[model samples]
Target: MKEKLVVFSGAGMSAESGINTFRDSNGLWEKYDIYEIATPEAWNKNPELVTDFYNQRRKNILNVKVNQAHLEIAKMENLFEVTVITQNIDNLHERAGSSNVVHLHGNITLAKSSGPNPEKKYYPIKSWRLTKNDLCEDGYRLRPHVVWFGETVPMLMEAQNIIEQADYFLVIGTSLQVYPAAGLVHHAIKAKKKLILDPKVSEMQVPNDFLKIEMTATSGIIEALDLMR
Candidate 1:
């Protein structure tokens, strides 16, 4: 059987692909207030602004191509049972051909009902333009599928289960600052090897067992694959 390689990725993984990271200097957060753009309260107050914000993000995803880091991770599926657990909302991993992916935060390319049970069904946004006119079958407005702040991460348990069974656990491009998601690394106790690839590894406080590769995702993933081999 192929070894189970579980990869946990974050905004940094897609940063090189031209997707802006929220916490970086002059990043998205610098331009927009988190409370105004990424909170349930904001959506309640101004759904149009929230909808338009995600629409632009979806358009951004459509314009950007998958980078070398994404392709490298996808290629690993040939050698292992690769399951990607990503905090990003983009579809680049799937576009790059990774068979199994779990989006911890959610996918921006899709829309869900603004109804109470938003998780019941996900509707694919045809062209990165989900407007207020868009409504689910239940007759509620369609909202971006992303998990906003003050929202529970529905996929967290499933991610933990996958991590617990991993033979190799790889963390890429994440600052490990986000909660619940950041705590996932602790579930990989059974993993024979654990590694994190990022340029700012020195600033991270990870478990002692992790092999830190302090490089950008594109270069770091290549080095990580070589070391694994």
Candidate 2:
């Protein structure tokens, strides 16, 4: 059997594909307050604003193309049982031909009901525009299927299981700052090898054996693929 390779990716991984990171210098978080547009409270306070925010995000991603980093990562399937665990809401990974992907954050192209049961079902939207009046089959208004702040990451357990099973654990473009998601690195403690790729990796804790590469996602992944070869 091929060795299991789990890729723990973050916003920076998608940034190479033109998807903006949430907390980068000119990132979406800078233009909008997280509490205003990315929280359960915000969705409740102003559902219209929340809908508009995600609509724009969906529109942005519709035009964005998957970058070299995503392509290279997908190619890893030839050597390993590759599973990409991403913090992004975009579909770039899927578009890049990656077979197994665990989305830690919710998907922007889908919508869930805001009724009494918000997490039970999700509806797919063809267009980038998910209007405020759009309702689910349950007669409740539709909301972006994103895992906003203050909400649990439904796929965390699945991700941990994948990480624990990894023979090789690769972290790309993540600052490893966010919680729950950030904590996933620990789950890979049993992995035989760990690799991290980021330009400005700071004082984050990791296994002493981790191979740290300081570069952008595309460049870093290129080098990583070479090393794997």
Candidate 3:
């Protein structure tokens, strides 16, 4: 039987593909206020602004292609039972042919209802734009299917379960700063090997046992795959 490989990825994983990282220097946060664009209150205050922000992000995702890191991770499916648990909302992993992916935050490619039980249903946006006229089946406005600030991460438990069962746990491009999602790494106690791939790995506070590769995701993933072999 193939061993289970759980890869936990963050913003830096897609940075090479031209997607902006949130907390990094000159990132999106530097240009836009999080409270005004990424919070639930933001959507309530000005849904149009929130909608447009995500629409532009969606358009950017559609324009960019998956990088080498994404392709390498997908290729690992040939050697192990790989499950990608990503903090990113983009579909690059899927586009790169990674069959099993668990999105921790939420996917920007889809929209959900603004009404009660919003998570109960999701609507796919045919294009980059999702206007106020776009309403769900319940007659409520369709909002970006994202886990905004002050919102609960619905897939956290599922991610923990997947991590616990991993034989090989690989953390890529994440600074391990975000909560709940960052804490998921602790669940990989059973993993025989734990590795973190990032250029700033030395600066980050990861467990001593974790093998850190200080390189960008694109280059780091190649070395990571070599070690696995």
Model 1 ranges with Cα > 4 A deviation = none
**Tens digit per residue, CA lDDT, model 2, 55-155:** 89899999999999999889889989999999989989899999998889888999998878888988898899998779998998999889888888989
**Regarding lDDT, does 2 or 3 come out ahead?**
3
Mark the regions of model 2 whose C-alpha exceeds 4 Å error after superposition.
Answer: none
Q: List TM-score per model, in order.
A: 0.99, 0.95, 0.98
What tens digits encode model 1's per-residue C-alpha lDDT throughout 1-229? 9999999999999999999998899689899988998999999999999998998899999999999999999999889999999999999999999999999999998899998989999999999799889999999999999999999999999999999999999999998998989999899988888999989999989899999999999988988976665
**How accurate locally, in lDDT, is each candidate?**
0.93, 0.87, 0.93
- Candidate 3 lDDT over 68-174, as tens digits, reads 99999999999999999999999999999999999999999999999887999888899999998999999999999999988999999999999999999999998
TM-score of 2: 0.95
Name the 10 consecutive residues with the lowest summed lDDT in model 3.
Answer: 220-229
Q: Which stretches of candidate 3 lie over 4 Å from their true place?
A: none
The superposed Cα distance between candidate 3 and the true structure at residue 31, in angstroms, equals: 0.5
The better-scoring model by TM-score among 1 and 2 is 1
